[model samples]
Target: MARIGVIGTGYVGLVTAVGMATLGHEVVGMDKDEGKIRKLKGGEPPFYEEGLEDYLKRAMEEGRLRFTLSTEEAVKGARYVFIAVNTPMDDDGSADLSQLLSASRSIARALDGFSILIVRSTAPVGSLDAMVEVMREEGKERGRDYELAYNPEFLREGTGIYDFLNPSRIVVGADTPEVAEEVMSLYEGINSPKLTTSIKNAQIIKYASNAFLAARVSFINEIAAVCEALGGDVWDVAEGIGLDPRIGRHYLRPGPGYSGPCLPKDLMALIRMSEEYGHFPHFLEAIHLRNEAQKRRVVWKVKEALGGVFTGKTVGVLGLTFKPNTDDVRNSISIPILRRMSKQGARVKAYDPMGGENAKAIFGDAVEVYNDPYEALDGVDAVLILTAWEEFAKLDWDRIRERVRRPYIVDSVGIFRRGAPEGWRAWTVGKGDLPSPEVSPESDV
Candidate 1:
């Protein structure tokens, strides 16, 4: 079994450490966060991901996994050191490599012998060069002291562990074919297509892949807007086009545009990276602008539904996370949408199965986050479904209708495919029917 050190125990690093341990490797995960390291040592995950706790427990029980606060202890004598630190988007739309470069410097000082340092973070194309420079300042030379490789991770947030264990494909880029092969050996038992290429290509593949997915999301949102105007069902349109072997159905479902830790940041980074290379990516820029517009469009739909006024309205929001099955609210679309509504004098109440606490922290005082979905929906002017969580679909619409002041819903994710409850006026994206005010119960007399 190979000894592996995974630096930065955030979502990617934690999942990688556990996944490597599960593969029978002796893995040590290191992070600077004392609290996070303490939690991991106690077998408590800092964040939620499906099946992560079980897998982490199993790996720890087998004595193949451990956590540490010392970078030197983690990387010393390891065969492979994976740098999975966060490369957050900077104000200038480029990747801020501060954390990554800091990790590399630490790893350089801690290395005992020749090891393969694999970068698992999503960064710009030339990020490896910056890492090499930093390591060189610490008196570590590449090819002699350690080998560098790019192995970008493509794990989704909610399904990160599963994605890591059962990846569709593995791409490893190194300076030499031999070095690439050695890095690929880390996943020996996994039966997936492994591609060995240059570092530049690997980085591009990572950026292009996310950019393409973001583009697909923006394209579908634009189509959804068109459908709303032309009275065409985008759901049907997406399916019909998706069936064409060239286009897949994934990322075609329209909602409040793509907003997550990776997609938006990566898309913006790519746009900036491309611009730095003297080529303006009009298509990518448009995709980004369209995503922003889609978020605004959701607010507009809510405003129009409320007779063009948000004053004194209590908007109940269902789903606050960027997606379901994860607690990550880093760049959720719900934040901006709700903030706009709250600023317009609307009282915002929201609920999510997992993201409530995080949303509460972000929206503090502006949004009332409830543990119970029903409580959030109680006595509201309108209900907006944002994240498309499965539980939202099975809600007691009858009870909701009774509690809500007006039976109006702006279903951005189209959770009510069967149509809203009787007497409810629902405005669904990409649907022809526009929501009309529900007639008061006394009007029936």
Candidate 2:
């Protein structure tokens, strides 16, 4: 087993450390955040990721994994140093590499012997070269003192641990074939095909993959809107189109928009990166613009369901996260929708299985976060299902009907596939089966 040092204890860094340790490697995870290091060392995950604590605890007990705040302690005597630091998006959608560059400089100073530095951060092309430059400026020649490699991560937040152990593919782009081989050996435990490429290709691979997925999502969302207008069903249309192996059935689900730690920012960053390289990515720009438009469309849907007014109205939201089983709410559609409603004098209440804390942090007093789904719906004028959580799907419709102040329901996630109750008004994405408003047909106004 090789000795591994991972810098950064975020979702990517911490998960990679625990996973590598579980594979029988001695791992030390480092983070500048003292409190985050303390929490991980105490067997607590700083964020809400499933299966993280158990893996961390098990690896800790096995003496294979440890957490630290000192980069020196982590890098000393390590064969592989994985740079998993955050590359946040700047105002112009360029990746802010301040943290990554700082980590690289710190790691450069601590390099004792020949150790492979793997950049697992989602950065622009040539970032690996930039790190190599940093190492050279720190008095370490690439071939003599150290080496740099780009190995981007594809781990999703909720199912990250599993994805790490069972990745679809592993890619590492190094300066030399020898370094690529060494990087491959580190992932020998994972039964995934390894692809070796140039460092620039690997960096672009991550960005390109994310941008393509975001494009598919936006494309389907546009079709979903058309379906809603023309009495067509998007789910069935997607099903038929997905049967073709070339057009696989992934990221095709219609929703308000694609959000999370990756999709939105990655698309924007890719666009910016392309511009920097003197390329005008018109198609990618369309995808980006369509995503923003989708969120606004959702807000319009909510207002339309409320009889074209939000003044003095109340809305209940069933989910706050971008998706189910994750606490990440970065760029989530629910945020804009809920905030827009609140600004229009419509009180907003929301419940999520895992994202409530993050929702509270983001929305503050503007939106109400609730523990129980029924409680979130209590006396609201309309209910919107933004995320596809099983708990939200299995809600007692009978009880919800009694608790909700109005019968107006909009399911953007296809929760009510069997259709809503007879006497209620309902709408959904792409289904196009909107029942008439809940006015008694026998009454002649």
Candidate 3:
């Protein structure tokens, strides 16, 4: 197996480090945070991701995984050093490459010779080329050229481990095809097809992939709004369109628009990159606008259900995370919707299965965060579901109907059924109206 060094112990870094080690590679994950390194060395994952801790522990037990704060120690004698640092966008929308450049400079300082430095961070198109320039500049000063490559990660936080092990394709980009071949050899155990390209194409591929998915989500969400207006079911519409062999279905669920670390940021970065090159990515721009509009659509739905105003309305929101089974709330669509509701004089009560703590940091005292989903509905005027956690699908809506002051529901994620309750008013995306339920005395309370 390849001897690997992973820099920057964030989600991607941690997963990549541990996963490579689990695949029998000798891995040393380096970070400047001593506390994080200490925690990881003791078998504690710095964040919550399903199965990451288990795999980390297994790798640690197998003596293949190691953590260090010193880059010198981590990269010494390692044949492959994977740079997995964050490349968050700046105020100008251009990628703030400071973190990446810092990590590259540090890796450069520690390089001995003939080691492949792989950039695995999601970066703007041409970013890999810029990074190669930095590496060659540093190498020139040190009188040695370090081999460089790029392997963009397509990992989703909640299902990161599964995605890594069963990736759809493995991409490796480099200065030359031979460098990509060397990089591909590192994943000998992986059965996925490999795509090799130049540095510029590799960087663009990552952004293009995310931007296309964002477009798909926004396109469907926009259609869902149209369907709602026309009394048509968007689910049926999307499924019908998705069945086309050319369009194959995935990411067509119309809900609170796509929000996570990747899509929004990558789209903005791509836009910024396009502006730099004197071109306008009109479709990507439209996608971004549509996503923001989707968030506002939730607010409009709330206002409609609450009689055209949120003044004095008690609104209960279910699901706070950007999506299901993930605690990450960066740019989560729920945050903006909550802020807008609260600003309009609505009392917001929210319950998320796992994102409460992160939500608390964002909302502060503006909204009441309930530990129990049912408790969040206490005396609320209407309930809105944002994230599509499976628990929401099976909720005792009969009990929730009894607790709320107003029998109104807005099912943005399709959590409520039609013909469920008398006096029950609900709006669902991509689906028909929620049915009123058969009322029973015991079930009502």
Candidate 4:
């Protein structure tokens, strides 16, 4: 088994570290944050991902996985050094690779022997060229002293571990065929279709993949609007198109737009790159704008459901994280929707299974975060279901109706039925028609 060293301890890095160890490789992961390192060393991960804790604990127990705060310790005597750090987007929509450059320079200085530095971060199209230049400036001779390769990670937030081990495809971009084959050997344990290409193609593939997924979401949202306009259903439309082999049934389900660490940032970065190349991508730009508009669309649905008066209205928000099974709230739609509602003189109460603390930190007094989902609904006029979490799916509709002031629900996710509680009124996305049942004396909601 080859020794592996991974930098950064975020979702991708931490997963890579523990995952590689589970594949029988001795792996060392490094992070600058001492607190994170301590937590990782104590068999605890800073964030939540499904099955990561168990996988981490097992790797630690097996003596295959370890974390370090020192870069020197991580890179020394390692055959493969993977850079899985963040390349956060700047204010002007460009990617700030300061952290990536810093990590590369650290790796260069700490390189004790011939090792392959595989970049697994989601960077710009030509970022590998810049990283190579940066490493060369650090007095490291490329292809002789060390080798560079680009192997961008394509793991989802919730099911990242599964995606990693059972990837649909594995991409390896390198300066030479020999280096690419060596990188591919590292993933010999993983049984996925592999592809070797240029560094630039590998880099662009990540961005293009996310951009297309985000566009699918935005297109469906726009189609959802039209479905409502023409008195049709988006679910039916999605199913009809999804049945075709060419257009698979994924990313067609619509909600409050796409928002996470990857989609929005990658979409913007690709747009910026296209602009730099003198080709203004109107389609990508529109996809981005439509995503933000989807958030506002949720607010509008809430306001309209509450009879157009935001003042003195207390709305309960369900699920603050962008998606389920993760506590990451980097670009969650619930935050902005809650802030906009509060600005319009409405009170907000939110509850997320894992994102409660993150919501409390971000919203402060603007939104009151609740640990229990029912507590958030206590005495609220309306409840807006943002994320399609499993708990939200299995909620007691009978008990929920008793807690809320009104049985009115704006289900952004199509979890609620049309007439489940007899009198509860729910507005679900892509529902073909709204039902008007006969209200009894006990059913006047």
Best by lDDT: 1
Q: Write the per-residue lDDT of candidate 2 for residues 272-365, one digit (tens) a residue.
A: 9899999999999999899889888777777877777788888999999899989888778788788888999898988998889888989999
lDDT of 3 by residue, 387-427 (tens): 98989867777787778777777788875534334556677
User: Highest TM-score, which number?
Assistant: 1
Expressed as tens digits, the lDDT of each residue in 89-128 for candidate 4 is 8898978899999998899899989998889998887677
Give the alpha carbon lDDT tens digit for every residue of 74-193 in model 1. 999898999999999999989999999999999999999988999999979888999999999999999999999999898999899999999989999998999999999989999888
Candidate 4's C-alpha runs over 4 A off are 417-420, 435-445
Clash count for each candidate, listed in order shown: 0, 0, 13, 0
- Residue 72 in model 3: shift from native, Å? 1.6
User: Which parts of model 3 are misplaced by more than 4 Å?
Assistant: 132-143, 417-423, 431-445
Residue 8's C-alpha lDDT in candidate 4?
94
* Candidate rank order under TM-score: 1, 2, 4, 3
In order, candidate lDDTs are 0.91, 0.86, 0.84, 0.86
Model 4, clash count?
Answer: 0
TM-score for candidate 4, please give it: 0.95
Model 2 Cα RMSD, 1 decimal: 2.4
TM-score of each: 0.97, 0.95, 0.92, 0.95
* Stretches of model 1 off by over 4 angstroms after superposition: 434-445
Error of 2 at 229 (Å): 2.0
Instruction: Return the clash pairs for model 1, or none.
Output: none
Higher-ranked by lDDT: 3 or 4: 4
What is every candidate's alpha-carbon RMSD to the true fold? 1.9, 2.4, 3.7, 2.7
